[model samples]
Target: MQKVRGVVARAKGEPVSVETVLVPDPGPGEAVVQVQTCGVCHTDLHYREGGINDDFPFLLGHEAAGVVESVGEGVTNVAPGDFVILNWRAVCGDCRACRRGEPWYCFSTFNAEQRMTLEDGTELTPALGIGAFAEKTLVHSGQCTKVDPSASPAAVGLLGCGVMAGIGAAINTGAVGRGKSVAVIGCGGVGAAAVAGSALAGASRIIAVDLDDRKLEWARGLGATHTVNSKERDAVEAIQELTDGFGADVVIDAVGRPETWKQAFYARDLAGTVVLVGVPTPDMRIPDLPLIDVFGRGGALKSSWYGDCLPDRDFPMLVDLYQQGRLDLDAFVSERIGLDDVEAAFERMHHGDVLRSVVEL
Candidate 1:
């Protein structure tokens, strides 16, 4: 067993604590990763707040990049010394989705069979099956996706979660193509990445909608052609006007709120796609809209889970693009912090003060 420092939420609505936890040696199909950096994503905060479930004493970091320290028997996909980004969706090839050749929707994703625990022998639930805010983490070997070691860990790790979600929302889920017009609501990490993805896809126009001017400015840097202050203007109207009065070819709702979702619903042209990438709380519901509008709109309405990404296929390609300087992955790193600062990062994220605050181990 290896004793390592890790961030844990002991209860709902309580601040996370850095505690020494015992990480067992990798069992079959498992691997141990020495985490280099992990991003403080909203999901981590949500897990701490009990938004995900009632699983207490949850290990809270998921977005991470690390070096493989060891692997257990039956693990051949990765080896010791490999640099990788941790992914939650470790496709199980025999599952229905994988059998259908859609591993991105793999019905049976893998995680380590063993559990990490506190010194007192309490089992700890790792967030998203990755609890990476620690100095080291144990995961299924399939969760580790090898990438170029030359890339910045802080920047590339974002691809493990929010960044990947946004890009996949545009390219994979929305099927954004050359000359298409795109609009992304909520100009945060995921939304801004969607704009960048749209631009990379050769979108003719990319509209970024957000309430914060700072986020809008950051969105412009990431290739948003137009910015809309939703608090000051009607987001749907602005998007429609920007898209030649017919609305954009694709509208992505990154905010996940009913109001923002409604805006995205009406801000697309007839037959255009609307991708809802933002996660909604269990208590939240889609507000009532005219049933005729859904039928008459004649376009696809879809939800993007983890941007519908296949990590094995997408991670390396995106890392290559970042190396080539075509994609500004660095723009997403607003700050670098220590593990102790994650609570502060949560506050900054809540206030829209930073795109991402990476915790360097």
Candidate 2:
């Protein structure tokens, strides 16, 4: 067993604590990763606040990149010393989704069969099956996606979750294409990424909508062609005006609220697409809207699950783009912090001022 210090959310609505935990040697099909860096995503904060579930003493980090330290018996896909980004969706090839060739929606993703435990012997639930805020973490070998070691771990790690979801929302789910007019609502990390993805996909007019000017500025840096302060203007109207009154070819709602979703639905031109990447709370419900509007709009309405990405296929390609300087993955790292500062980072994220606060191990 390996003893490692990791951040843990001991209870709902309590600050996370860095505590000593026992990480067992990898069992079959498992590997141990020495974490280099992990991004402080909103999802971690959600886990701490009990927004995700009642799983207490939860290990609270997910977006991470690391080097493989060891692998258990029967593991052949990765070995010690391989640099990798940890992915939650480790596709199980025999699952229904994988059998049909859609591994991105794999019904049975893999995780380590053994559990990490607190010193008291209480089983610890790893956030998203990847408690990576620690110095080292154990995961299924499939969760480790090999990438270029030379890339910045802090930047590339973001691709493991939020950034990947945003980019995938545009490229994979929305099918954004050349000269397409795109609008991304909410302008947070995911929305800005969607904007960047739209630009990368050769979108001619990328409209970024958000309440905060800072986020709008960040979106512009990432490649938004227009910015809308939604607090000061109607998002749908601004998007339509920017698109010459036809609305955009694709509209993405990175804010999962009913209001933002409604804006996205109305901000698309005829036969345009709407992609919802933001996560909603369980209690939230879509406000009533006419079914005729849904049918009359005549466009696809979809939700992006981890940007509908296949990590093995997307991670390496995105890393190459980052290395080539075409994709500004580094811009997402608003701050680099130690593990102790995660709670503070969570506060910053809650205020919506920063894109990401990455914890360097």
Candidate number achieving the greatest lDDT relative to the actual structure = 1
Off by over 4 Å in 1: none
- TM-scores for all predictions: 0.99, 0.99
C-alpha lDDT score of every prediction, in listed order: 0.95, 0.95
lDDT of 2: 0.95
Angstrom error at residue 86, model 2:
0.4
lDDT digits (tens) for residues 25-48 of candidate 1: 999999999999999999999999
For each candidate, C-alpha RMSD in Å?
Answer: 0.6, 0.7
How do the residues 57-111 of candidate 2 rate in per-residue lDDT, one tens digit apiece?
8988999999999999999989999999999999999988999999999989999
Per-candidate clash tally: 0, 0
